[model samples]
Target: MAEITAAAVKELRERSGAGMMDCKKALAENGGDTEAAMDWLRTKGLAAAAKKSSRTAAEGLVGVAVAGTKGVAVEVNSQTDFVAKNEIFQSFVRDVTALAMDVNDIDALKGATMPQGGSVEDVLTANIATIGENQVLRRMKRIEVAQGAVIPYVHNAAAPGMGKIGVLVALESDAGVDVLEPLGKQLAQHVAAAFPLALDETGLDQDILERERAIATEKAAESGKPADIIAKMVEGSVKKFAKENALLSQPIVHDGKTPVADVVAKAAKDAGASIKLVDYVRFQLGEGIEKEESDFAAEVAAAAGISKG
Candidate 1:
């Protein structure tokens, strides 16, 4: 058996960002070979990441890219915000946004050619190897307007547009690009900050409405009012919920008084064009993931190699 020295373990630890004991174990398992130890660490990271796949990854980057009338928004997740700051990771996000403009589907984006001399999958694999961590291209959406423009907004950071959230809005009109593009971009930024649930009330999720109605009905029943009055209360509550949740029904973020739909209309009037907000896409990282609660006592006990007292 080859001897595993402290120096060898430390070197491997620096390369992998893994614990010292983990590096030592990898070196010991791989006959004290640095190259083999590196591979071992990478395999461990991949396994650890797989375990974390079901965990909420709310801290990641929302990236956007635009070319003329076409724009794309993508959300890429990482286990930690620190990884989001890595230059290679940021570059991967930038390229993924550009790829999104060309491919409408996630699978297509995965199979698309990567500029650094391989397919997207190949590049991802190489990045995992180089970064000593596992990464994924989570989801993407693309929008384009043949007549007007698809403007993009990324809030928080820029590796050419990687941030905490991203938005894309498509404006369809006969207006010239100079007049329409600026307005479209401003609206996109507004959408990012506002985080609207739907483009309009029509698109609001029925499940949410049902849930809201149930809550409202329970609250109204407690009032001991007549059945007709209770029904009216529930209906009124639902309307209020829908207006608050829906994108267009919500008051404009910019003015804090006008609805977003009205804001767009006013912009169209100023530009002297009949503009319509056909569609919009917003991606925020880690919105739905149920973050597992950590048991601090158990963790401390394990670290100390002692049974819980």
Candidate 2:
């Protein structure tokens, strides 16, 4: 049996970020071979990560990255907000967001290889083990423009391009970044604040519209109007709802008067180039995710193997 040197254990600990005892055991189990010990440690980490996967991870950061005419946003969630501030978690989010710029979807981003010689998912699993908390690469979105700018904005940033809210504005224009960037930023900020559901009325979900129409119909019936008048009232209400919720039809955030469509048109006229608000992505951290509500006393009691009478 090869003697497990202290130097070998320390090296493995540094490489794998495992507990010192675990590193010593890994090195001992692998005949003092660092490479094999690394693989062993990663296998243990994978198990640890799986154990943590059941914990709720509704807190973390939304990361954004932009390169010229393309941008991507990624949301990474952790078990607590404190983990979001950790440098390891932040670096992982940043690196994953940078990788997301080239991928079209979340699956692709997960499968994409990282500079550190592993897939993004693999790195994420390792992080979960070292951080000792559940984390998830919740979602990713990408936007691009042929000739214009895809600007990115991070609201309440925890780091450079990661925050609680991430927004991307895809401006399809013939103008350069100098002109399109500022306009895109304004639009992105509006998106972050206004929370538009879609680009236009046509882009709104059919289900949501149906629900709105049903509500309008019910309200109109309460007025005790004639059937024909009620029909007209319901239609008017649906149209008004769409106008208020759709991005292009909604009023701009600046003056609260001009429509967003008119704002883009005015910017185009000023820049002497045609600009189109082609697409956008807004990812608020843990949006729509149901979090697990845990009681601290119960958790402590459970950990202590104590049962309530």
| Clashing pairs in model 2, backbone N/Cα/C closer than 3 A | none
Q: Give the clash count for model 1.
A: 1
On a 0 to 1 TM-score scale, where does candidate 2 land against the true structure? 0.78
Output the number of the TM-score-best candidate.
2
Model 2: lDDT to the true structure: 0.85
Per-residue lDDT over 1-309 for candidate 2, one digit per residue giving the tens place of the 0 to 100 score = 899977678656665668899988888889888766665665454212110111222899999999988899999999899999999999999999999988889999999998888999999999999999999998998888778889999888888999998999999999877888899899999998888889999998897788667757866787899999999998997898788889999898988999999999999999899999999998888876766666788899999999865
lDDT of 1 by residue, 127-220 (tens): 8898877677888888888878888777766556778777888888888888777877778777776667788888988976776677678667
lDDT of 2 at 86: 99
In order of appearance, the predictions have TM-scores of: 0.77, 0.78
